[model samples]
Target chain A: MDNNGFASYFRFSNVDWNNMWSATWETVWMTLVSIIVVAILGALLGLLLFETNGSSSWGARILNWVVAAFVNIFRSIPFIILIVLLLPATQAIMGTIIGPKAALPSLIISAAPFYARLVEIAFHEIDHGVIEAAQSMGATRTQIIGKVLLPESMPALVSGITVTSISLIGYTAMAGAIGAGGLGNLAYLDGFQANNNAVTLVATVIIVLIVFICQFIGDILVKRIDKR
Target chain B: MIEFKDVSKTFNAKEGQVHAVEDVNLNIPDGKIYGIVGYSGAGKSTLIRMLNGLEFPTTGSVTINGTEISGLSGKALRNQRLKIGMIFQHFNLLWSRTVIENIEFPLEIAKVPKKQRVEKAQHLAELVGLAGRENAYPSELSGGQKQRVGIARALANDPEILLSDEATSALDPQTTDEVLDLLLSINKQLNLTVVVITHEMHVIRKICDQVAVLDAGKIVEQGPVLDVFKRPQQTITKRFVNQETGSSNLDDTTVVVSELLTKYSNGVIVKLTFHGDQAKLPIVSEMLRQFPDVDLSIIEGSIHQTQEGALGSLYIQLIAEQQDNINGALEYLKTMRVEVEVIKRG
Candidate 1:
């Protein structure tokens, strides 16, 4: 490799180091908060889906249909479209439609339904015999869900969360297009529009690094918890 | 006591309604190990699940200790189930929990304190011979060991009644015997009423005092284990008994009888089924001593033990100088209460 060619490709003189660091922090903050909130909401929705659809007598059939329809509708819409569609609600919920804080509402709304579907699949993968064993032990529905269903499917649930978190990282970048203030905004405004290739390259490399780190942690945790 | 009073279960399928269980009435007395033996699709599982209210009867009530379990729901049903513990064929110990935790699950649901739950689980692990492997997960255990955990878990609630749904069906022969022995000991020590649903007749013969043979969702015959083994009234029961005793099929036995008849022009082929003391008596030697001129050759014989006593069957060909001697020998065998059948005469 020629030294001059590599130097020109990674020219750092035009990159604003302070702005890049702040954008990286903003991306981390938005992804982290959105992931935690989605984890909770998604797990609850997933469990509701599992119990209602798993048994005919559990909860109301119409309630199951309604929740299912809502999840499906949210999941079917593209993330970019969903962000635009939720602009009015986001302003009402957060008092502004800009910056990382404002972007969180749409990010959570989009990612939660996606993760809920995965959680439902995880719970469905647990052996029916295990659930039946709990029932035969005189366990109430709540006990069965907490003691059997959740614990038994923990590994899958954790893996699903990891996938959701990585997906949220990508969504946070897209949120930057509408002034959410993250690496995507820095890349779009300072790198692409300003014709600085080095800033965009660094931002893209950091996003890839975050995804890899999430995948590694997810694989390790899955292996640790999956006793079966 | 568990009583199924005209119970029936029907499933609504796309094609039509499938009758899983039909008008079944069974009385299982207390402090006894009862076996419900049947082939696949015989509704043995459906019948047993009713005892714990896991599956309710469509038409009739299932009375356990005089409480109709069929109408129970929610907390009432759960409270009723607490008195009846069940084990499964697959030994469904929670894969996420250790053996001890699995055993403590029922106690936890009962809201027993953590300390008491641990103490009781330890005691149950020892009782089921899973003492040293308390922390081991179900994935690490072998099939028999997994089943030991299952048994310990079922007994953790101090239930008076235990239901075993083909608990040994997934185990190998040796492991099946070990599990069955553990169940037998548990039944005797705790005086727990155990209802075992199995396709294997040997499982019934090994531990059950009473045996009910089900076929096509109905109990074709049921009685004391000895009675069912010796005098199986239904064709399915007879086939199960034959399989258990290592006896030849009817066609093979008939062929043997026919061959003996052609070879010995003046011989008698008699099938003698022995029960209790009759099985131990030297009937053949005694007959030879009584009639010196008669020579008897054993064709086929098998003996097995049930909860009742030793039961056996022997097919013998008696070649005598006179037909009257064979007749006298048959009469003497009948006097001893041996079911004697003359299969062939020449």
Candidate 2:
């Protein structure tokens, strides 16, 4: 394309780019906040997955079954459906269902359980023998969790977090489906409806950059922290 | 001092309730090297793990140094564990850490200062002859070296009690001896009490000051190494002693020669022990000079030094035909109290 075509398809002015920077900041804000919320929430729920024991007790079995059913129910529905279904819940909590800030609670509620299950799998991969050895060494349960289990399973945990972060980025993009103003909404309302290919191309580049940055940082952190 | 009072450990395996250790009460005196020997699943490993509170007894108490470590909890158990160190059959050196770092782990967990931890690890690495290879990982070292690192790691806490669970079972014979020698020297230098568990009779016969033979999880027989060998009470003990002293897997030629001695050799068949049983050199020549026409012909022999003392077994054929002369020879041999076994007629 000629420079005229290129300039028409892109936001080339420095001041114009700066003017739209709030949207960019909101996208970053949505992605980061949702990830933190979801990761923490999911990790906690995942621990519940491992701690339940229906097999050994009737009450534990019943409670475990109910929790298992709940986790699976949340995990199976599509994220978009989850967001739409959470509209009432979101409005109840936030007094509005349309803004990015109001949409975050649902995004986190959706992502947390998914990430938690992943954390459970990572935690289970640690050798029972190592835990037994640590116990035999007189390490307390807390010590075993801190000194043995966490340190031992950190590589998988980091990778799990990487996967979660990348997926959460995608989920944040999906948040725009509900009029949440992230790059996805920027593409939808401005780029698609307004026939502005500039917005579409910018949003695509931004999403790709977010994924690459998440992946590279995850790689570097795993390399640095994992001894095994 | 360690005392096991009627201890029994039973595990609920999928197969069934496996009695890993039956009623076993043993008194392991302070500063003595004790051996609990049995085949795999005979409860040897479980017996030792119990002493360090790694395995709690099902039906009895284990008192160590005035404390019943049987049910010690959390911080209390850890504090107890700091007083008892353990080494495993597989070495169990943390594969990620260097030899020095691995050795320093107990100290590290115990929160010993970094400088002291390093110094102690270095000293222990030197003690086990891994001084130069301190920075090497477990994967880089030989099986023997890994075990040395394990020994050093077990000693890092300077525990009064060292529990070895088949510690030398994985190494080559030569390396096993080297590790055993290192343990012996460490035992002497540190005056540490040691309890080793193994399926190998040679391990018990080589370094145990006192030994308990566990058969089907019960202490079938136990005593000083020499006493147990010379006068075994249980049939299994008899068999194990025979395996250690009666016959070695020498060439067929030696087996054939032993058969020949038992078949054709006459007079008095005597087995002479060397400075091999448990202590000083016994003057066997002075005892033998007492016999006229004794004509000692050695048929088979072995020299092994255990922790108690040096032990030896020598099979010799004697020359005597007359019943009176045989009786006299027996009389003379008994005076010296040498172990004599009748071979064959001349």
Candidate 3:
């Protein structure tokens, strides 16, 4: 309960309690915002990929190639390199390149394709018979996607986003090392640079806890929704 | 009535051109169960799918009432599909939905009002004998129960034609009969034209009034169920008939009959086939009474009741001191509208 007393016991000579709180808030905010955007964009991209995969139509084949190329290219890039590479786009979008907001472009761009691949696999795991049954019932393309594909693959989609969220948390930390203000920024600046071991340990523990919480919630959601 | 006029479906697969259905012509009268029986890959599935516009024929047309199903596309095709409900071998009930919800799916696609959909689904659930288990998910239901749900869902739209694609193939014999009974009752009660595609002759025998025996994308033999049972023209058709008659166990029957022949040197084995109303008569008893000197012994007997009438096959051994007595008994049976095949004689 006593923040300063807790800090002193661990020989936390360089620990700033106020800065640590702000940094934790920044990390949570970046992950939260980026994951929501990623879920939407990723799911749409994945649906398009799956729907167009085996299509014989000229339009669908071309769209499938373009979307597939974008996903593959973004997914192959290392997160750290992606952030550096997207700095110009980041500067244009956020008007600055040194805070949590500046990291959004790269965070979404990097994670969306990763989650999109997951989403496509999730859709593939659905029973083809279920889709056929929907078609037999006179369901339109949109109706099939909405009523059958999406609802049937909900558990997989949620678990996918949960995984993407955890990875986005890690990406936020990586984004932090380049002057984005988060727990990673705090740990790198105040712990590693200043030779303070306690600050690094505390930040690592918080990041681990966030990942655990995300996993726990994801498990419950999947269990509740997965009737199969 | 539904008609398939020179319908053929040839799929261009990776290997080459594959003819699934080859110039098949069929006439399925309204309000009757028509079966397309075949082994796997006989193109029965492809033929049935063309009725609902699920698979368009490569040539010719499938017309239900007056509408050519193969000629329609997009919304028009889909709307036509709404009128033709289909059930699968897998049941294909949505795992994410409850029994009632699954039944309401087609109604939802048709954009029926929620209250009306719920009422109609409830009625169909009861009709298919899934009355109390409306809240159960497909995973919680047994194979038979899931198929009951499938029947309920197929009937939700009150479709004029119900396409059953091996709907009872995955079920046990007892359950297959139960689903077939439900389909038969639906056909009668709703006047729905039912097209059943299956490899099982039991399915064709039990409910189908008319049957087309498909072999390698062609209808090798087709006629009324009783007529087919009485005389199967093709080898494949004979095999399907044997499936129901228990005649496929020919080796066992031969062993039993030959053993009986060995025991009685004076015995004569006659394989008697009784068709239609003759199966229910005392024709066998009359023959024995007329030739009282002959000893009558039944080896193996089976009577299958089809929609048209009963088809019975019996193997009888007649042992008499005089060969004339056995000959007289065989002649008497043949005169009573029975097909008599003399298996062996002393």
Candidate 4:
């Protein structure tokens, strides 16, 4: 189709296809970086929750309570409010709070605890028998975590990350309202404000497509890796 | 050798303190299959767990080869554990790992090189008869096969002592026998001291050289398997022996004697325990030959083989018009080393 035919069909002459593509790229970058950061920090915190709370010891119990309280406090706050609350910290860390990089700190802070809870549930689902077996074999705590717990709970963890990633996608769109330019910014400023219904619908479809692709890949990977 | 010196484990619960084990002293010798038999909640599991240092005693010491296991910690405790391998009732193989990978796990923890780890795992897999199923996940295997993987994993470190905590309890009778046989072979081939905790006396009868009967968190009776079967001192021990031999219960013996007393007023009822050489002898023929006037009617009898020897018991009614001949027959039976207990009309 010619440029005019495309413009008439979409009902918007100032679509700025390059800007929409860049915004999509921005959303992808923010989501990916936040997921990687969340995965590492979340797994460690999840393991701490698992080990400390699992057995009956006063020291571990206290530590578990502290960590659990921290996670719960962060997880209970609304993501939109959390982004605003973390604005100073994000600006200090990134030297700006209005782009893809600036969105990461808030995204990670919001998602890590959420993902940590998921990770704890994933590790909790593993059989206690497996841990006992490793202990009987004289595995150290580190070995037990790396060799036994992590491998045994990989499928659950992967599925958790997929869920977290999808949630982060939605959060990234919210980050756009705070001047963190992405697909959400395009939808709000260009489509919603410009009275372009076509742009809004197209942006919504692209976000949905991204989440769908992530879920589909996550499902396949879980199926492939889960020996159990 | 593993020795428990006044070891007792007590756990604090909301209700009260639960004494899992109480003042237990056990000596398990090297290169022997020792069975600890008890019903559920008898602290058999706790007692075995102490041997591996999984559960520490509340008030005493557990020594393996004269090394106090309770005092060990960190690397020392881990080193102690490496010498004592254990298997579980659930056959706790990691579901994510294949059979060979599971076997190689302990070796990996010990930091064995990959080549040697694979070789050792392969050897252990074949040892446990899982030679061709190295890549099979635990979920893909049968209960017996999964247990074989457990065995292989336990043996990866070449432990001197193998603790089996109701290892075959979850399997069928046929599968139980197979796993027991595998354990027996491992005990013999490696000269591994195997401490088996089980509720089934049949397991003790099959391979255990020494047996201990645990009841209410205490060892009620313990001895060589044949001796325990032949002369069970505790009521629980007697019940377990009777269960294994399918013989009349001790209380039932009294009922049978009373019934015989009403049926035959002149006859004397006697219970005879025949063990080892005595069980093989034709004591009934000899008794008849020695006292022709006395007539013997076998009421209840059973003979079974233990790891040590054959043990048998017979409840007999001795009928005779003359009481002197019955006494003479009893004397003759005792001369032949038969344990005779006069039940009625002595």
Shift in Å, residue B2, candidate 1: 1.0
Chain A TM-score values for every predicted structure, listed in order: 0.94, 0.88, 0.95, 0.93
CA lDDT of each prediction against the hidden true structure = 0.90, 0.77, 0.90, 0.89
**Over the full model, what C-alpha lDDT does candidate 3 score relative to the true structure?**
0.90
> What are the root-mean-square deviations of the candidates from the true structure over C-alphas?
2.3, 4.6, 2.8, 3.2
Return the lDDT, model 1, position A152: 94
lDDT of each residue in A163-211, candidate 1, tens digit only: 9999899998999977899998898898778778788889899889888
lDDT of 4 by residue, B140-173 (tens): 9999999999999999998999999999999999
| Highest-TM-score candidate | 1
Off by over 4 Å in 3: A1-9, B259-267, B319-328
Kindly list the per-residue Cα lDDT of model 1 for residues B225-327, writing each as its tens digit. 9988878888899999888988746678778888888888898888899988878888878878888888898888888988888998899999988888888
Indicate the worst ten consecutive residues by lDDT in candidate 4 chain B. B247-256
Error of 4 at B138 (Å): 0.9
Higher-DockQ candidate of 1 and 4: 1
On the 0 to 100 scale, the lDDT of residue B338 in model 4 is 92
The per-candidate TM-score of the B chain, in the order shown, comes to: 0.96, 0.88, 0.95, 0.92
* Model 3 per-residue lDDT tens digits across residues B1-346: 9989998899999999999999898899988899999999999888888887778999999999999989999999899889989999998888889999999999999999999999999999999898999998999999999999998898888899999999999999998889888888888899899999999999999999999999999999999998888888998888888878888898898998889988998888888998888888998788878988989889889888888888888988899998888888888877776899998885
| Model 4 CAPRI quality | medium
Task: Give the docking tier of candidate 3.
Answer: medium
